[model samples]
Target: MSQPSLAPYVLKRPWLMRWAKPLSKWYFDAAAYRKLGLRSDDLIPEESEIMQRAMKRLTPKESYDRVFRMRRAFQCSLAHQLLPKEEWTKPEEDIRYLSPIIAELEAEVTERQGLEAMVINKPNTKR
Candidate 1:
């Protein structure tokens, strides 16, 4: 399969984030779904380099439908697949792989809440 892209974008540029707000508000405020999407979508391209340079960075699962209600488990499974035992010896090491994606999720949530204002306004926060 082709590798995935993890390029970041503004909230307005991505129509899904904008339009999903109403439904998001109805369900966990969409923060969890958005975080799952953020992690899942970001797994591919960064996989190789991340696994090599920062092997702890676990990868999220590939397929998820937020409407299905099982998305969180899917997200966990994705991470398991992305960072299998054969690849990582320790859980902390695998957790390192998740740092970048988790950071992005936090920023996205903050932006959506209008709390911190914008991703750019906050420090780079990348780990």
Candidate 2:
């Protein structure tokens, strides 16, 4: 057989070029900012005071849900770049697959917050 067309073959292989564009875009857009319902900075708190004020406006559960949804939307956009066009179109399926992982992360954040509160409440306790 004749020698294979190397460049064309490389592009055809999903594993080889799958992350090419998405990873590049991620590097370029490192800010993770979006302008949907509100301006990027408006939705995202820039300082401790803003975060605290926003948290006060939202109940604990509401804030958690709001944050989770925002995070998912961002994840979908990022994942779209990494996934093939066909896979990217089915965002619901992607969300289903990713939900558990997000939940685990959220739980970890909640656990860390609880630990911080405990430490603040009982400063003398090393444990």
Candidate 3:
């Protein structure tokens, strides 16, 4: 299961969002994945059922792009070098691509479980 996050609550408040924005930015910047040309979503582990489902849902182009990024990142890291600054993933390009798919898959699983667990209640009158 996904960890509970205060993101929704913080995002709902302009003041909190404003306060957290730069902190989040700094955190991501420090992560340095952008320097290797990888988006944030590219770091998500693909070992679980939910992630596998999410992977299957990706468009062909998206899947190809994701693999390309991972390979490129791997090469860069192994070489102990970074992508050229111009080649680094742009702030706008580092958006979460797989997260929405994973969330959707998780929702589907939860809904299926709820439906399967549902019990029907019946009322009877003397016939």
Task: Assess the local accuracy of residue 33 in candidate 2 as a C-alpha lDDT between 0 and 100.
Answer: 32
What local lDDT score does residue 59 receive in model 1, on the 0 to 100 scale?
A: 31
TM-score, per-candidate, Cα-based: 0.20, 0.27, 0.87
Off by over 4 Å in 3: 12-18, 121-127
lDDT of each: 0.42, 0.47, 0.92
Colliding pairs, model 2: none
- Candidate with best TM-score: 3
* Model 1 / residue 106 / CA error / Å: 0.8
TM-score of 3: 0.87
lDDT of 2 by residue, 1-127 (tens): 1124566765887887776657745753454332211123234443554345445555577556556656655666676633333332221222222233334555666899898888434467665
Candidate 1 deviant stretches above 4 angstroms: 1-95, 115-127
lDDT of 1 by residue, 1-127 (tens): 2334433443446776676656545664233433333333333344454333433433333122212324444655677633333432222322223456545655665677895553665678789
Best by lDDT: 3
Which lDDT value does model 3 have at 79? Answer: 96
Query: Which prediction has more favorable lDDT, 1 or 3?
Result: 3
Better of 1 and 2 by lDDT: 2
